[model samples]
Target: MTDTKQEADFLIHPENTFLYIWQLFMVALVLFSAISLPLYAVFAKDIPVLLIIIVFLFFCDIFINLRVAVKTKNGFCWETAEILKSYRKGFFIPDMIAALPWWLPVALLFKNEEPGIITRFLFLLPLIKILKIGHYLQVFEKSLTINPTIIRLIKFIVLVGIIAHWLASGWVLIGPVKEGLPADDFSKYIRALYWCITTIATVGYGDISPDLSQNHQIIYTMFSMILGVGIYGYVIGNVASLLANIDVAKANFMRRMEEINSFIKNKKIPLEIAQKILDYYNYLWETQQGGNDSQVMNELPQSLSIEVSMYLNKTIIQKVPFFTKMNEVFIREIIMQLEPLIFLPQDYIVRRGEFGDCMFFLSAGSVDVKGSNGELYATLGEGAFFGEMSLIRGEKRNAYIMAREYCDVYRLTKESFDELRRKYPDFDQQVIETVAERDAMNKKKTEKPAAPVKKQ
Candidate 1:
């Protein structure tokens, strides 16, 4: 079992770089044991160096499991006694015996004589490590940022590859080992692999058909064919599911677009207006990925939501001269109530003569300060605040505030701002000081004479 204990309590963090590296090393050792053990047991000759490593890792794994944090039914078991108890109750014995290099001992014991089927089964004992792969995958799933669906798909492929490798190894020891085998182990393994793939994928080709005369060989071939059919069906279903869910955001976006189109068609809306709506939706999909940011924040606990909202609007607050001098508590209280609004290109957030109950703070993209005849006075980018003077004084807007591009603007309602300001006496003085200068600047800009027309 992979332990994902609390970070403070962990002996080794699952996300630690060293832990992942160690896991990769262990997986490599398992693969080596899985392949070499069965193949070497047939000859029972010289001992390989990997057998030494496996024996060493077998002991190391015991200590690693005992110390590493383990999660349990209640939660992560941080107590040392409980950790040991969990390990003892889990795969400790089977993993211990399976991880042992039993084939090494058998090879040495029967050095002069070749081993039989019963003795060869000692090499296969290590196959249980293959089962513990599920445990290792849990660690990877936590540490790696890759999509789980992608991981599962890759895992399935690797699993099939390992199964084929195992079957190929066994195929070599099926009958008279020398009858139709290649000159070398590599070539022999390759031939066995080819037969396994062809046999399992489809009924084997005539060129590599199994001998019908041997009862065991026929039975083995039949099982492989049956297993192949099951594998084929399972892979197709799972792979299809994975591919469909790979782009969930896109899927949701399309569904929303379809519903919008249906409404547009039913209402007999003009093509130009419909196109603009579609463009607005496209911008929403790109920026928010077909989801409501407010709803997402609302789903989080109030404490977390407050921190996240404040963090996102932190820069905007710092940029506001009125807010910069205010205490963090006042800033945070106001920021939490700010609602996000997106404006598409050329869309007027507030027209030159429209009354508004809210002000906007630009968080991303840019907007234009325009007047009659679409005269652009200024292009405000991120951290720019506008529409406040109108809200504070309860007067009509002096100039058009239009989005120059897709803009993410956070709106603070007059009611919310008033509520927060009421609790702080200094807030009124700061607002009065800032809006006076802003009012003078706007009056000058809006009063400017019209541009000269070129004489033709």
Candidate 2:
């Protein structure tokens, strides 16, 4: 039953699932509809079924946009007045305009005659519908989970296609290829496309050269050459940068480890100690993504890192009684002061009677608390914290704590605690209240009668 409930919960991620479905649907709709427009124009008589399917898909796209606006916040406004306001000045206004072309054809249905000049021009609505690609690009950029490099690459590809289509349209409209060709409109566009690709790639094949005798054709050709150089350079630079980003951190870490290994050998360090060092390095590399946490944090702006840290540590820190009532800023400060730690199985984290200077927040795994005689007192798991009593009161640890398994924890030292208390008077009061409660609990435990031991 528990497994079933867990599975149900896993299936209940609402926003992310909706966004994923939305992205896929939009990509398919745009690609299919966009490609269909040119083909429909070329072979209008041959593929009546394809034209109907394209028309149906266009209407589906309009409804899809309406649904998106209704379901997604800041999509299209839900209120009538707000929807009008958004139509005037919102990100979705272009999408609304793109749908207008579909309605024009519908309006012509009332005339019941050969299409008018307006209706014929309305066939060009597919050009306006291309705006949806830009809308999707904006959406993809805002997504946190998607890689920015991939998003940039997608944008580049789409831009190149759009540019190529525009150039081909210009070429066909200017009559550079001549009207008497036996080939159809599709064949003409294909020839224009071939010229555009060669020009943009700077691979002037000379077989399909543009008609440079005409001034417009010469200007167009020159523009294509310049644009091609810029696009080619942009793609090369971005791909190189992305590859460098992928390799730099990993390569640097490997090189540093090699140097460390060579030093260990030169110093004749004990094999057991060297192995432990290597294990520690490996654990850090795996967990920290091959960089020092402090150094990484240092690179980010203080406010940005604080927000990120607060997001990660807020839930765990809230389990600490003293932090329960603290404000976000206070909690963020505490998170910034915390240091990460990892403990191996059976490792003694805190020994009984030792002066404790820090408290631990167990982020993962389990630990056992034992009394002075090594009898188990209690076991604590993830989100559980301990050592606060000693850290708060400047006293010796009352019990020994050891990791029952490999554990990850965050430690907050007394110095940071003291600084916080000094900065925030409210923190001092919370600390005092927590200390009193701990003292009272300890007194009750000391007063209780000892349990009788069972005979073996």
Candidate 3:
């Protein structure tokens, strides 16, 4: 079962299995129609089975569109009237033109009749569906969890195929090749496709030269040349652009590392230190995509930032007994104040005998809580936190906190905790009482050494 929140995000009800299947079917069907419909018009006279299927699906989509949930600022609006209104105001006309009976009813009435201008014009009506397909594809993209780049790449490939097919169809209409037009439709299409491939790619092998004597052929060849240049440039540019954007985070991280490497080499840094620096950055890129979470959050609106922070910290925050009981608003406040920290392997997060001024929550990797001489006390994995005792007692850290691996942790400073604790009497009182108890114990231990010696 799909979660309501996720469904809300997509503005659809997953509970309607029929509707879900229909939507998936339509997205694919529409794509097929977008490519096949135009090509079929150029080559074949009789209606293809695909045209019939598309026409049927198009009408069915209109019916389905009216009942599907509509998303608004509040949430998914399930009201039929609203959905209808939305459909009407949006792609209703394009969809209507695309789905109409067009030449189908007439073709059925006269099976052997040649398609006239009327039939051709009607056949072209469904081409408008191509416009609405993009709109539907946007929704489709949102529904799928896959990377948008993959979808963009798919779209690009489909576009190139469509453009190539269209060019081939146009070539067939002109019969521009020196060998003249083939008698058979299949042969005509294949030869046209071959010519288009060579010409569009600017690889016009001598076998398929255009007839320059014929004015139309000459004009067509010149147009194709100009068109080829645009397409050739576009294909290269688009491919480069797509590759650049495919993994922007990784690219940026790699570029930064290059800069760091150049600097290190220029400065003649020690190999060991340079290697450690490289490892730290590589680990950072691996774990956090080389981004500072707080800085990224800062760019977001306050409400959205808080929501993201809450989501990130929810698991760790819930693990804390005190925090679990905190009010939602206070929890969000605490979450916002936390700064993400990452410690390299064997890095001291907490030095023994160092005064602790902050608390730590291990969000990823493990840390070793050890004694002064590297005697490991325990290992803390993801969601385990430390420094609450320091927060309560206002004392030095008793144990060394070292990251066993590259650890991602979130730190909440004492100042922020102090301010927050004061707002809640229970929290403030608990800290005050715990500190007082520690102070009293320390005083007793100091004074009791002579008494212990006398007893011995």
Candidate 4:
């Protein structure tokens, strides 16, 4: 198995075991709670207290479940919200179930950080409100994923909510309809909410009014105007941002598709091979786009022309250490024969025992040169050449070369070397000189002895 696969398997095994234990514990808790609820109702004879305890326990269970869900990597906010809703319904169980708004619990859980005890308790109300809002947002996000059209619908809802709150608060202070209002009835709350919505939307019909006795018209008027402007701006800003993100995503997708098409056309790849290239291209594109692509072989296509051109340019630049002193035409010819090779991290570029048929010019990244002494002799980076000894002498590689990271190399094979040598007679002399200098350096390093120890 690949290293990634092994690591994934290791991570998953523990998670699965933990999930199983968690489920078992939850089942036990639920069964115990179910048994205790009725027993307490019958024996204790204090139904309200028993009911309160049961309700509190149910909420506690929900809190625990939500905590677990959020901690898990695959946690879905919607799922956690649903659990909270279910717990609330169960706790209230009978007539006119008095469940708090969903946002209350969510906001509490997602607070900025730990605060002073009193501050934390004070913030709890807002936190719960925000959590309920987040739950709706989570649902909206999921809806967008399934049907993007829902994004517009969600935006409209937010605008309506903002407008409603603004108008209701404003109308209660300024409008005539608010005068001589009954304080106790449900109609009072409905009218207040309605007026707030209208004022916030900036569609004041002048029907509602505040009592002249209150003399707080200016405060309500200022509050509504400010809130109206903020809400309107927020809605517009969010809508604009969402649209921009969608446009960017579409543009990127088109760009990748165009790249794939260009690759297929330029390479003249067969349909089957082209399909694989397209798949791989998509994989790399998604990786670049930040998504999963394991189910599809998202390997990027090797554009022969582009790869060859890049190899020529990089090889010529890298070979400057050797070729700057040589004829320009000869350097160009040598570069033309070189091919680009990609190696993943830790891949052996040149195994010690393998018969080396090519010399590699590093275009990018680093490689470790493992010597016979079982230690890394040196690390070679871009512009460095390796496996050249075998190319000059027609022998096996003297050292192993392992990639330190994903690398791109320009390789000149033995056949290409021989052809170049036959074409350019002077090349042999340069190769011999380069090899001799490297050998002399190696010999000196080996010959150098440890210094005599001073008597202590």
Query: lDDT value for candidate 2?
Result: 0.72
- Arranged by lDDT with the best first, the candidates are 1, 3, 2, 4
Error of 4 at 36 (Å): 78
Model 2, runs deviating above 4 Å:
1-24, 46-78, 91-97, 100-122, 161-195, 210-223, 246-282, 290-348, 351-353, 357-359, 365-406, 412-456
Q: Top TM-score: which candidate number?
A: 1
Q: Give lDDT tens digits, candidate 3, residues 339-404.
A: 887788989999889888999999999988899888888999999999987875579999998888
Listed per candidate, the RMSD to the true structure in angstroms reads: 6.3, 9.7, 5.6, 21.7
Model 1 per-residue lDDT tens digits across residues 423-449: 888998898888888779889988978
Q: Which clashing pairs does model 2 show?
A: none
Considering TM-score, where higher is better, how would the candidates rank from best to worst? 1, 3, 2, 4
lDDT of each: 0.79, 0.72, 0.79, 0.57
| Lowest-sum lDDT 10-residue window in model 1 | 1-10
lDDT string for model 2 (1-456, tens) is 253652443321223566566666766766766655544443343324544554556566554443332234633233434434443564354455454545344444745554443443444565455666666656656666665665666666777887777667556555366556657777888888888888888898977765767887788888989998998898787867775555566778898899989989999999988987787778778777687766777899998889878877799999989989889889888899999888977789999988989999998889999999999999999889998878987899989999997788999999998899999999899989988887899899889687999999
Q: After superposition, how far is residue 20 of candidate 1 from its true place, in Å?
A: 3.8
**TM-score for candidate 2, residues paired by index:** 0.57
Displacement of residue 50 (Cα, Å) in model 2 is 4.8
Q: Please list the residue runs of candidate 3 whose C-alpha ends up more than 4 Å from where it truly belongs after superposition.
A: 1-23, 38-45, 68-89, 105-121, 143-151, 170-185, 206-223, 321-325, 430-456
Q: Which is better, 3 or 4, measured by TM-score? A: 3
Clashing pairs in 3: none
